[model samples]
Target: MFYGDKLTELRELNGLSRKDLADKLSVSEQAVWQYESDKVTPRIDVLNALRDLMEVDTSFLFEPNMVTRGVASEGHIAYRADDRKSRKKTRTELTYLRYVEAFVDYFEGFLTQEERSIDSLRSMTKQQADKIQYAGSQREQNLEIENLAEVSRNYLGIQSNRDLMYKIENSGVCVVERNLGQEIDAYSTISKSGRSYIVLGTHKKSAVCRNFDIAHELGHLLMHQHQNIELLTNEEYKEIELQANRFAGAFLLPGAEFACGFATLARKSNPDYYVDLKSQYLVSIAAMGHRAYDLGLLDYQEYRYFSGRMNTLHYRKLEPLDDKIVPIRPGKLRALMEFVLKSRLTSVDHIRSLFHVRPQFLINLFGIDQHFFDQFEHEKHSYYGGAKVIRMPGA
Candidate 1:
């Protein structure tokens, strides 16, 4: 009974193009229009494709003003936000102050807009102070940050390590370091469906640094998401950096428990004590030192001493600890790729271009070897053309 024009509207609303709709239908663009214009009634099978692809109730198509309700995920949650400060601000600790100042301004706009919109729609609230969510939807992705602040008891030699890093081994974020001239080694994007946050980091960073950077960005998401004002801005360099530091530390060492752990370790080791702690925590020596300082296990003098020694050891700077090619576990990134490929959301080339990384970067990530590209025609039957592998142009 419904016309194809109605189908077109739904498709557009759900962010689908005619070509995309056609691919899903296994038909031509013109045929799709015929059904919409009521020129011809599609068979039940084509009708089913319309229902599934558009995510609209086909039965409700003839109804008036029927908007497909996006099943409400948890509402947008933002942190005490601040704006980005001046880009010109030098990399000084105090510069972060300006960033926080501007952040206060930008954050308020988003919050006000959120309030007005949510009030118009049927909304529900979840009891959590802060959460990680996709940038587009601002919906919570990780629930652990809700208690990151209050969980630490700061008891004897113990800090409550709140906020969980759900070790999503099957999927993870990666930064794209290209063979090009200059580019930041990392990037972040919210999903179109508001389902997940995608972080692309170059492979140069070690797993620990990559882990910390991702957590740091997650901290920004949780802390500055819904603030009524701008957050640590360009001027508020120190505050922004401090927020990052606290977030990184909070996620990694945990406040109370890490402190207690440090105290217990420090008392036993004394001078060279952090060596034992470093090995135990599986964190960098610098991280160990900073965690000790945060837990009050080391006085300012002790902290200065340990920090200086670690720096001299070149642990955080130009030098690194023993390098071991730890086997890569398919993490959140890989999982997301699989979902995209299976769902036909976008092609593999589209994803690579969206992230602007080396094509080989993603393909090689989940045990997808690159050597097969040498002979696609002759090796069509080989793993290169296997169902498990999806080829994009750049890749």
Candidate 2:
């Protein structure tokens, strides 16, 4: 029997509507709806078209959706996208995230998941937020965010600004780099299976920008875990965005240390002076200047002059050392695959059979480059005979 839900999932995952699929199949929109509703099975040609378009095997339509069977929901997604985000785009992104979570869940079954501090961090952040109420004055909320940042920084064991992405991944969060379109920078969410994900965009962003994006999403993951972002008003959403920004600044640059340093080097409003500090802090000059102002290291007039000098120097977009420091990429998933494949625990064919998708589909879905899987092609032997389907508890 064909699974309509599978078709629906693929359609949405591809960011397509029933009408769009119907047009592709040269069928009526009602026909596509019926196929998705399981009221009617698609013809062989239509099925083949779907298999071609969705980049899945024909047998995928009949197989049980292992991805959705274990997972109940995608959970609340907190992203810093444009305010004019379309409903369709949001749906596509969330469904895409759900599929990624399902893939990660599959890979995690064979490995020992060490105890993580992410849960404790979230609990601590929530407790702090409750204590502060965050609904008080601006100064009060900023203080609360600063406290949360410090708490998270300590929990993640970030002594310096180095290896932030690695530390976050070590805390049991699955971070992935993906092209998140033009409007969005990054997003994070907790999956129904109790996994946290942070997706960073590969869109023309500098290394420091990506670091800030990660910290921003971390703020969302910790601070707004309970808020239903989809139901939030525009003003409410803006408030959270501001809070996340403040958290990012505080998290990246601790107030006391940064202020102490800024007082020595930042006597005047010179963007060039920040260039040297940028190398040490690994933060953009604009961000550092903003943090200085927030910390009262720069007076209003001085900060305004600094902003003018920054614009004059054209350091807003691509600053110095932007290209020198390589942007961090997520390696946990790649490392897992390496361990599994290199150890002969599994094969590429076995993975394909499990997912029932083409290699290109997996490549596109994971948002990793094409050449990543090519290296493992030499080890494409069948290991399914020895591989047991381990049924994990609560999975």
Candidate 3:
């Protein structure tokens, strides 16, 4: 029997309304509702059309529901967007995240694998969460954020800011670039199962900006983990966002080092001078100026002048060297898949079959390029250890 819940999952994951899917299937809106309500099954043609339209096998509609429990509520998700997304958009994003988590769950079955970086990272995050101690006052909270930033840096074991992205990935956070629309820069959420995920916007094309975005979301994961942000007033939400921003600034540019570096700059107010520091810190000039102001290295007048000069130079929108530093894409998922395939633990066809989805659908979930899947289209391998074994003559 066809399961309506699975259809509902796919429809919502596609961000489509019943009417949208109905029109695609050349059927009435009510017909689509009935199919999803289990009031009626789709006709053969409709099933085939739905299969083609959704890029999933028709048999997938008959499989058990893929919904996973303990998904973070939309309100629980920490977003770094300029404006709040609509409920529909948030639902779609969370739905997509749940599916990604589900896929990771299935993928990890082959490894028994904490030797898998993600697994070890998850364990570390849990331990760190227990040690977090929230402060009572606003001033204390600010101090706490600074402390956490330093703690996070120590946790990642990086000596320099340059390897921030690499350290974050190794820490077991799933970071991926997806088109999160114009307003939203990034978001992070932790599942009940202890999986941490950060989704970065494709609009943030600058490497320095991406670094800050990642750090901002990391602040959310570490600091705002338990807050019911959806229940907070507008003012309260803004406060947390400010805290995350402070955390990002401190995390990317540690206080002592940043102070020492800023001391070396001859013209603290000149944006041009900060450009020299940008290459070393991989931080935008504007961000460096803010850091300088925060650290009291730049007085009010100097900081004001730096801000004005940034706007004058158009550095506010597009900073110098923004084009030179290429942004880093999230690599843990891709790396895990490569290890699995090269180890001959699983074949691409097996994964595709397990998900009952086309390569394009998998591409959306994995945040990987289509060519990666294209390369494996014709490849086949005999399953080893799990079900079948391939004998090597030399062995």
Q: List where candidate 1 sits over 4 angstroms from the true fold.
A: 1-192, 198-200, 227-232, 264-272, 318-322, 325-330, 336-395
Candidate 2 local lDDT, residue 143? 86
Model 3 C-alpha lDDT per residue in residues 1-395, reported as the tens digit of each score = 99987888789877689899888888999998898899998889989988888888988898775658557787778999766543347777887888888877765655653443544533555444334335566666666667778877886887877777777876778888787778788888888777888889887569999999999998888777788878888888887888889989999999998888888888889999887789988888888889888878889998889999999998988988999998877766766665566666676677666677877777776778778754633322222224223332321
lDDT, model 2, position 228 = 80
Best by lDDT: 2
Each prediction's whole-model lDDT (CA): 0.41, 0.79, 0.77
Ranked candidates (lDDT, high to low): 2, 3, 1
Give the local distance difference test score of model 2: 0.79
Quote the lDDT for 250 in model 3.
91
Give the per-residue lDDT of model 2 (tens digit) for 1-395: 89999999899877678999899889999999999999999999999999999989999999988776433233367777765463336666777777887777677677666556897788756887664445568787788889989889988999867678778887888888776778888888887767788888778988888888989999888887778876888898888888888999999999988887787784557878877778887888899989988988889999999999888888886788988988777766766666566665566788778888887787777766688667854322232224444444433
Predicted candidate 1 versus true structure: per-residue lDDT over 1-395, tens digit per residue = 66665665555533356677778899998887776676877788887777665544455355443222221112221112132322211121112112122222222222221122111111212223333322223223222342443332121112221112223211222222211112322222222223223233344655455445555654544354343323334454444445545656666676565676666763432335655544444455566666666656677987787767666666665324325423132233333344334545455455334433244433433234454323222211111112233333343
Evaluation by lDDT, superior candidate among 1 and 3: 3
Our model 1 lands, by Cα RMSD against the true structure, at: 16.9
